[model samples]
Target: MPRSRMLEYDGAAWHEDCFLCSGCRKPIGSEAFVPDNRRFYCLACYEQQVAPRCSHCRKALTKGGLTYRGEVWHRDCFLCCGCGSALAGQTFTSQGERPYCVRCFSSLYAKKCAACNTPITGFGDGKYVSFEERQWHQPCFKCSRCSVSLIGSGFFPDRDQILCADCNSDD
Candidate 1:
């Protein structure tokens, strides 16, 4: 522990006070000690216990990995829940803790239009009209006869169809 007995490493003299490794409490003289979280670990402990691991593969992430929703995943291990497609660098949706692609998510959860028999996704100018607990597209809502728009206007229900006030009176 004397200055005359100090060991020189990397052009600097290291004393006995800093000679012990944090993991095994063993003397680390010239051996490399990896620093992690402000604590130094021996080579064996660093590779076995202190290294970061992927959540999906459960293996040590040797290269760069991604952290999504607080879960770590390697590039090849990040996949969609619905189609099992790769989700790396792609937009995804989550159901509970499972990740799914946009196309798969829409097909599974999108609402369909009752009048047009097509999915009524409210994207852009596609608007939905709800009447009598039934959903219809804006362009599809019309009277059965003469095909007149009945939105925000007086209309009558005839049998299994909707009719405009003028058409209902005429009939």
Candidate 2:
């Protein structure tokens, strides 16, 4: 017959009266357990009910969760706040405690065109050109003085207007 092994702690044998799981209110028996603050949790109870939840999906994370600004997220639940796309291993931005993909961030938050006074939402395949922080649609990018398209040629910003190098020299 095998002799029962005494579980010792500090200088005394560990008492069995304190071996209950806080979550399930069940005796821990000989099962594995962990300490949470001043309470003890059985392995199953901790994994099922005591773990932190993902902020995006609201599901409990068994092993680990990504923590940001006091919020938690699962690896697959960390999505762009604007378009709901995955942001892992991709360039992203944050606003008001929400993460966003680069395109969604630029489209939803970037400044408007100085000339047209419309939002430069660079969504989908749309493109934008900037001169001195002023943004314009590719087709709308024209010389302010001559109203000529400056798709490829160089242009300069004079105060609130963009002028071709030729127009700037004429001024």
Candidate 3:
């Protein structure tokens, strides 16, 4: 026969009343008391728990759902404010009130052009076989040889390279 162990506190010995599984309140051996949620439970009931997963990444959601703009989204499924793109599987997070996609967000760091000293709105390979190197907006720089603005012109000529109507007429 096995001897029953009495519950003991710092300086007092006591016996538990109504031994039950803390999770399901089912009867259990006096020795099976497992503390949980401020109550004791048998091992079997504690092992049957389930946790929620995030809808966006399908990972366990440790915290909970986030409410943004009146919509509930998993922390990972939120969209960037700048590009309106989904933000799943990304390591970076924006602390701003609105999020931004990687590309649109990087525009914040773009520097102004050195030649014209204007904000760089766009970029392209500035290579004309005949002319020296130059960085220009589509409308800013004319063909070096023609001096005509290359706004709507289908083509613009450099020293030897033929240019557009504006460039062709300038010289």
Candidate 4:
């Protein structure tokens, strides 16, 4: 009769030779293993067959990772589609299922302010005013003649220029 050492796991005693990995059917002799659905697997087999894969690189995510839009990704794989920068712990936006860093997103997609002709990124609590399909930053929304703020007051649109009511009367 042959004798072998035994190990106990999850209240079940398993002979070392009999403790085989469900994936490769190799003996799991004291090495780290993963248990799933009452089946045992070695680290290699578990990583190959059970670990979540990165959506971008299609590699097994054996450690810390990220999830976006219900898809999984490794930390190094969650990159901005625009500039190819890492987006972990950083502000980002998505367009057509791809991720982009804030700076890249603003440059590529944000609306341009009509008065200043600069991108009006709606970040950092910055406010803007939109009028007749044109947009402007709060500070840029002013009368062209007197430079008076037109917010919360009536103004006149005069040939691609905004004029305060007082300034419009003088024109």
Candidate 5:
């Protein structure tokens, strides 16, 4: 048999790549060309070849829309700069900046116990207290059963909670 180069449409013949629809490959006559590109296509096929939707939100991202990390996530889905964790359900310290996670923010201001030299676990009046022959933050110091810092603020022999000056004023 012989090959057919003639595209038949509604009893009319058209040339290849000349008046054929770019999408459905059907014959088109004097259709409007899209801006910047002269490709011709039927109205139905033109709509079908429109821009794709976002992968993350499944929303149509038209021209001038943003695409992040090759996926289309909303601007609010970005992570925190301090810990690089996703930001959600937390108050930001900086008005215009993304907030750090609890873990990251706590580590930023937490201080080491004077006696044990471990990170303080609770709030205090910015002072250290003696407990079991060791010094700890006022709130973190505790009795064996009561686990509370002494009320009177003074030092005792071999019993004191004094932190180094360098560790006291750190931010």
Candidate 6:
């Protein structure tokens, strides 16, 4: 065959017409192509055959997507397991393989604060106090009689009430 126009790719020289898409079997003719294991493919063919699929929607991911626990997901398909809300760019947590928004995760899984009866998230600077198998937000861990903070002070635990030394002596 006489070589009029040729292309050199991956150390092989071929006539321009012979360099074709592996999937569509059409002439590549210098349009953008992807080479996978010595096989050349056009963008459309590569997307269909080689691109990773979203774990939730099972669709090829041609644009931005996320990988969690070795599973792929489109941004829109990454939803909270507990509330069915979009989780992209938001604070989220996972229990096993399912993802949850922060609000839902806290409501469903966080330990209940003994004093205020709200979820103790244990996130950020919001520290907690634990005593007698019960937990409370740091601010809520106060003396039952004086309403004073018991964070660093010695206290007495009588039934459900936590009394500071002064309050305990007065009682």
**TM values, all candidates:** 0.55, 0.56, 0.25, 0.83, 0.30, 0.82
Q: Which parts of model 5 are misplaced by more than 4 Å?
A: 1-78, 91-98, 115-136, 142-148, 156-171
Best by lDDT: 4
Clashes of each: 0, 0, 7, 0, 0, 0
> Candidates 4 and 6: which is better by lDDT?
4
Error of 3 at 113 (Å): 4.7
Error of 5 at 56 (Å): 16
Scored by CA lDDT, what does every candidate get? 0.76, 0.77, 0.51, 0.89, 0.50, 0.88
Cα TM-score of candidate 1: 0.55
For model 4, what is the C-alpha lDDT against the true structure? 0.89
Evaluated against the true structure, the overall lDDT of model 5 is: 0.50
Better candidate number, 2 or 4, judged by TM-score? 4
Model 3 off-target regions past 4 Å?
Answer: 1-76, 91-95, 108-171
Q: How well is each residue in 1-171 modelled by candidate 6, as lDDT tens digits?
A: 576588998789988888899999999988999888889999999889988899999998877999888988999999999989999998788877788988898898988888888888866646999887888899999988889999998989989889999999997
Write model 2 residue lDDT over 40-77, tens digit each, in one string. 78888887778888888787786655777788788788
**Top candidate, metric TM-score:** 4
Please give the TM-score that candidate 6 achieves against the real structure: 0.82
| lDDT score for residue 156 of model 2 | 81
In candidate 2, which residue ranges exceed 4 Å CA deviation?
Answer: 1-4, 8-18, 112-170
Error of 2 at 54 (Å): 1.8
Poorest lDDT segment (10 consecutive residues) of candidate 5:
162-171
Taking the tens digit of each residue's C-alpha lDDT, what string does model 1 give over 31-124?
8777676566778877678777889888876568898889789988999988899999987777778887777766776566666677655554
Model 4 per-residue lDDT at 92: 84
lDDT of 6: 0.88
- Assess the local accuracy of residue 141 in candidate 5 as a C-alpha lDDT between 0 and 100: 47
